[model samples]
Target: MKVENLYSKSEENPMKALVFDKSGIENLKLKEIENPTLGPHDVLIRVEKSGVNPIDYFVVNYIPVKPMPHIPGAEIAGTVEKVGDHVKGINKGDKVIVYNRIFDGSCDLCLSGREMLCRNGGIMSVITNGGWSEYFAIPDKNVFKIPENMDWDLAASLPVAALTSYHAIKELEVSPNDIVVIFGASGNTGMFAVQLAKKFGAIVIAVSKKNWLKEFGADYVVGYNEVVEKVKEITEGKMANVVINSLGSSVWDKSLEVLGYNGKLALFGTLTGADVKINLSSIYSKHAKIIGTTGGSRRDLIELINLCRDCRVKVWKTYKLEEGAEALRQIMSENRDGRVMLQL
Candidate 1:
């Protein structure tokens, strides 16, 4: 079918996307575009909502795209309108969430059940067109069916941020009475990390700016400058069993300092800068473990979906598709109180 025929041009067919051409953020625009085509292993989804991630802006400005034109978005929720012949376990009219990772499924990491680590993996927004538009196409394996009654905005917001939290917490195997320190607890992933660590029965000690403390669910909250001393005081010189670091270099040393003996520090994002200095003695003498994680596996996504369905966790806010750029801008500004979504 022709791309124009897939969407109604006479009825405000504008997609409302954030476009990053060669010029940069000044070139970012909200406009309509031709609908994307479905591949043999793909599904055509009429996007109901999309999630704005920090990486979206990073990709838009810093990361170089092969061509001048690109759509910057990763997570999305929508209804399936068309399915490729090989697609299975899903059908047209089903509500679904799309994962950004696209793997070959034959790589060493995929064979080891770590598709997110696939050396040849392709991320949706980074390597391909993502969910910034009203309608987009995705490989069948990249889509996870959502409940019919689930809010589209929630579905969109859950994938990227929530999934990252799930992987980090699950990998650490946090348990009751375990002291967990979450750095950057107010950001999208950090919020989910706080809740997920609590759900896993850990005693969460979140660290963020004082303004964001109440909403972040920390047993103790402190400013970035006071994190080490505050965390040390809260733990009574014991330190945390697990430290989840989202701020990267900015808090890397502090996170390491607050960890108890044999503590585990899971690094998920580098919202700060990449380069970091570490005290090898701290790690060596303590016998601490440092782990890194990113996108969730297919199985991890399934578990997260169930967690949301049971209402054990909740999404914070929703925005219309036309507001995608605004949502990204809000996230970039770090002025928002909750997760920002683009509803189609």
Candidate 2:
């Protein structure tokens, strides 16, 4: 069946979207397509901004998108254009952010508060058409109103980087006495990890080439090569009680070396590489705990939005919808300091 036929309240008007028929940036194109189909519990959003992330880059150049031609945005913020008959409390023109993870709600994982890992769920751009369009539609439950004081750029940037960082920090149970070290401190998730760790009162040591991490609340900022010695000196040989490594295998050894006995390490992304070689004694001798986290749960999302009401996040740059491809390209390019977004 045609994509338009899936919607019961179909509109004849066409909308512009940035899409790719297959996995490759060279295949990305901007064209007119039917607006997304809205079910009884759906809400139509006129996208105001779409934040670009490494996953969107992965979706465009590597991963398989279910629908042949797919829109590649997972972090979205916008206004309600329409609300289905069954949708309540959400009205036209309300500012909102997409939850990005689609869950069945009745699955075991969903019931246990792990909707991001639901038995029958998937991330936005990969499983369905996403928000790199003029208009997008999703289940009303997956959209939440942005706090009235939040700006378009901050709201759009939170769904992925901020939420993922928040979940990882929460999982590690950071506390005031814990000495925390965050690798990739200047990247998308890394930036938020710094702030959230500080908020929890952990003494944050940020690992990055940049010295500006202190502005985001890193108690100490050091280069990649300086992590071991610096962390040792800072802790007076106590080592870090928690290490947040989103960069993966390239820094795996150091991430482990910096951990104190009985410390916990959180793992999320693998921007460097996945495969790593580690001695069993290295883990056993230290009494280390390794946590693998992905996206945040619905509750985590709610908590983050509330906590970040007065918090600051960085938005590196903004591009027009026509500049979507360039916006994605910059995400993997050098000298990137903050989130890149597409203003619709």
In terms of TM-score, the best-performing candidate is 2
lDDT for position 133 in model 1:
77
Over 4 Å off in model 2, which ranges? 1-11
What is the C-alpha local distance difference test score of each model?
0.77, 0.88
Clashing pairs in 1: 15-32, 48-344, 319-343, 321-343
Candidate 1: C-alpha lDDT? 0.77
Query: What are the clashing pairs of model 2?
Result: none
TM, every model: 0.88, 0.96
Worst 10 residues of 2 by lDDT: 1-10
What lDDT tens digits, residue by residue, belong to model 1 across residues 1-344?
32212333354445556666763666677776655656567788888777778887777778765334777788888898889888898899999998778788898999888888888876777766567776787778778998888876567767888899999999988989899998888777887888788778788887776455555455666777877787778788988899999878888888888889999999988878768978899898999999988888988999899886633223356666555556666776655666776666
| lDDT of residue 71 for candidate 1 | 78
- lDDT string for model 2 (1-344, tens) is 22223333445787889989877887788888876776778889999988789999999999877676678889999999998889999999899999999888999999999999988889988877778899888888898988877998778878998999999999999988689999999888998899999999899999998777898899999988989999999999999999999999999999999999999999999999999998889899999999999999989988988988766667788899888888988998887877788999
Considering summed lDDT, which 10 consecutive residues are worst modelled in model 1?
1-10
